[model samples]
Target: AQTVTQSQPEMSVQEAETVTLSCTYDTSESDYYLFWYKQPPSRQMILVIRQEAYKQQNATENRFSVNFQKAAKSFSLKISDSQLGDAAMYFCAYSKDSNYQLIWGAGTKLIIKP
Candidate 1:
């Protein structure tokens, strides 16, 4: 069984600063996809970033990026210059195919301090 774990239940960062949310997963498959999703107050799941296990390079989108360590089974999200809008529940997920079915982690609520 594949599972994702987020050690931090909550994280805080000052506006204009950077914050990293830690996530780890256990999987037997060699090839898989990892994703970071953010759900704001409106309850909309937004794709932050994604990483392919077979790829050596990390994935990034705008101020969002991921440190994907396939060997360690760790995928952490880094949000640069975080704004008030970045305050949301961030979830880490693992999938074998596309975003159809995903094994998700206990999300971390991000607090942005002004």
Candidate 2:
């Protein structure tokens, strides 16, 4: 069974700064996919970023990025220039393959300090 874990239950960041949320997973498959999803107060799941296990370079999207360590089975999300809009619950997920079902972490509640 593949399992994703987010050690931090909650996190806070000042507007215009940066923050990184930690995540780890245990999986038997060597090749898989990782994803970070953000759910705002609206409760809509949005894909923040994704990483393919075979890729050596971490994925980046504007101010968001990931640190993927395949050997350690760790994948973390980094949000730069954080904004109030970024305050939300972030979940780390894993999938055996692109089309397979996802394994989700509990989530980390992110609060933006005004």
Candidate 3:
């Protein structure tokens, strides 16, 4: 069984600063994918970053990057130049090769301080 764990329940960062959200997962499968999804007040799950288990390089998108430690089974999201729009509930998820069923974390609420 695979499980995602988010130790932080809530996090706050000043606008224009940076913040990192922690995530860890347990899985026996060798081939899988890790993802960080952000759900805003609108309740839409938006993909922040994705990391393939087979890839050694971390994944990044604009100001968002992931520190994917395959050996430690940890995938943390780092938001650079945080903005108010970045404030949301972040969820760490895992999916086996082509499996649509995502094992999700409890979620971390990110608050952007003005």
lDDT (CA) per prediction:
0.95, 0.96, 0.95
lDDT of 3 by residue, 44-92 (tens): 9998888999999999999999999988999999999999999999999
Model 2 lowest lDDT segment of ten: 65-74
Q: Write the per-residue lDDT of candidate 1 for residues 1-114, one digit (tens) a residue.
A: 889999999999999999999999998888999999999999999988888888999998999999999889999999999999999999999998775489999999999999
55 in model 1: Cα distance from truth in Å?
A: 1.1
Q: How high is each candidate's TM-score?
A: 0.96, 0.97, 0.96
Model 2 gets an lDDT of 0.96
Per-residue accuracy of model 2 over 69-107 as CA lDDT, tens digit each: 989899999999999999999999999997899999999
Highest lDDT: which candidate? Answer: 2
Error of 3 at 7 (Å): 0.5
RMSD of 1: 1.2
Q: Model 1 residue 102 lDDT?
A: 94
- Candidate 3, which segments miss by more than 4 Å at Cα? none
Which 10-residue window of candidate 3 scores lowest in summed lDDT? 95-104
* Local lDDT at 104 for model 2: 96
Model 2 CA deviation exceeding 4 Å by range? none
Q: What is the C-alpha RMSD of each candidate to the true structure, in Å?
A: 1.2, 0.7, 0.8
